[model samples]
Target: MIIAAYNAQDTLVRAVNSALGQQVPVEVLIIDDASSDDTPRVAEGLTRLHDNVRLIVSAENGGPSVARNRGLAEAQGEWIAILDADDAFLPGRLQRMTGVARRHEADLVADNLLFFDWQAQAVAGRALRLADDHVQQVGAADFVGQCMTGRSPFDYGQLKPIFRRRFLHARGLRYPPHLRHGEDFAFVLDWLLAGARFMLMGEGLYLFTQRIGSISSDSSGQSRTILNLQAMRDHTLGLLARPRIRADRALAGLLSKRADAIRDQAIWNRAYPHLRARRPGALLMEMLRDRRSWPMLARHLVRRHRARMLAR
Candidate 1:
């Protein structure tokens, strides 16, 4: 298991322990992304406490993508499991996910996630619904469609799956370092676009904690997230433009829809600064061009009106 941590001192120990506690034999690799907090010290302490744990402190901060790629290069395991420093694996996560991969003959597999809302102190039983007790193979078109429409609980941005190292190495796949946020979404989409035999099980094996101060929580962070998503959408569209990807008409169409969905979101984000400057007319026009954008714009307007009323 590989964990990329940045300023996660409070949760780092628990995350490391969870990885170590897996039912299957596991080695933990903690990559500290030049954190200014006590994360490096905690990681170093973990290395001393367990022989299977190794800590690598990055000299410069390169974000999660760079840190994860660094861990991928040094990983010795056949299957790679990623654990965010703030998130953890439930018991038997490794054993069950690996077993499902072997049984289904799948190259990559992910299960449902359990969400723990730290601020709200609430928890969701499962992130996705189980179709059945059986493992289901996810098609490229279906995966892309779900991601584009939000019709399904499965999200490449959040679902942390176990990957086949050999398959990844064969494809020369690694997280795109240029993306500051939403890197996981692009990585998974890349695999799907490359025709990876992806599998999904209904079991919730990973606990995803949603807390304040995390990368995706605030306004500035969310702006970056949307922008990164836009970049990935553009990247996918570029690939779809090629004859190779375009040959698959079904997949090409799905990719186009996904790209359009992301473009709408990018437009929404771009309108934020203008909206702040009381330039609502242009923003309204942008939202009107895309039907999907109307709902988002309405919500924003509703929230602003509520705040103003409360202030009054």
Candidate 2:
């Protein structure tokens, strides 16, 4: 199990404990990304408390991608699993996922997720609603289609997957360090492009915590979020240019749609602050730079109007 932690002092223990409690034996690797908080100390404590737990402190602060890549390099496990510092694994998650992978002869396997609202201290909803016996084989087009932004608030990118270490090593596949956001989606996309056999299980075995201030739950208007979206868009455009991607018409079309959605989302993020401050000049400038912003702003206005009507 690989956990990339930064400023996760309070929740690190819970995540590590869940990994240790897994039905299948796991070697827990906690990579502390030069956190300013007491996360290193907490990780150290876990290393000393559990024989299977180990800690690695980065020399400099890198995002989750860098930290996870470091863990991947040092991991000795045959099957690799990722556990978010703030989230956890349900009992038997790794055991069950690995069983499915072996049965399907898959290079990568992902199960459904149960969203746990931290403030409410309860399970909110599930990531997928498929029947327990349902298992889907995900292809490149299918994966890209599900990840289109604005089409869904949550996407398949949120699914935590377990990968065969040999497949990753053989393909030299690692998370892109430049992307602090959507790195998981990029990584899985690369795996699929490299001919990975990806399988999805319907059972919700992973606990995804929805808490305020978490990286995944941050507001889209933030400057960092905008930059991340821009990076994802550029990355997707590059993928679309690839000969393999270009040859597959359906996959190319889906990727093009995903890139366009990402571009529009970035434009919306750029214009949202000005719209909120009622700065018509700045908003007009943004719309002029990207005409897509007009329709996006109009959609926001329509939603706000509906919300006001309901309140009245």
- Candidate 1 lDDT over 102-220, as tens digits, reads 98888899988776544443443455657536588887676766776232234555678899999899999999887766677678877876668889888877877753212222221
Candidate 1 global lDDT? 0.75
Per-residue lDDT for 70 in model 1?
A: 95
Worst 10 residues of 2 by lDDT: 217-226
Scored against the true structure, residue 233 in model 2 reaches a CA lDDT of 82
Candidates in order have lDDT scores of: 0.75, 0.83
lDDT of 2 by residue, 241-304 (tens): 8999889999999988988888888878889888767899998998899888887777666644
Error of 1 at 30 (Å): 1.0
| Residue 129 error, candidate 1, Å | 1.5
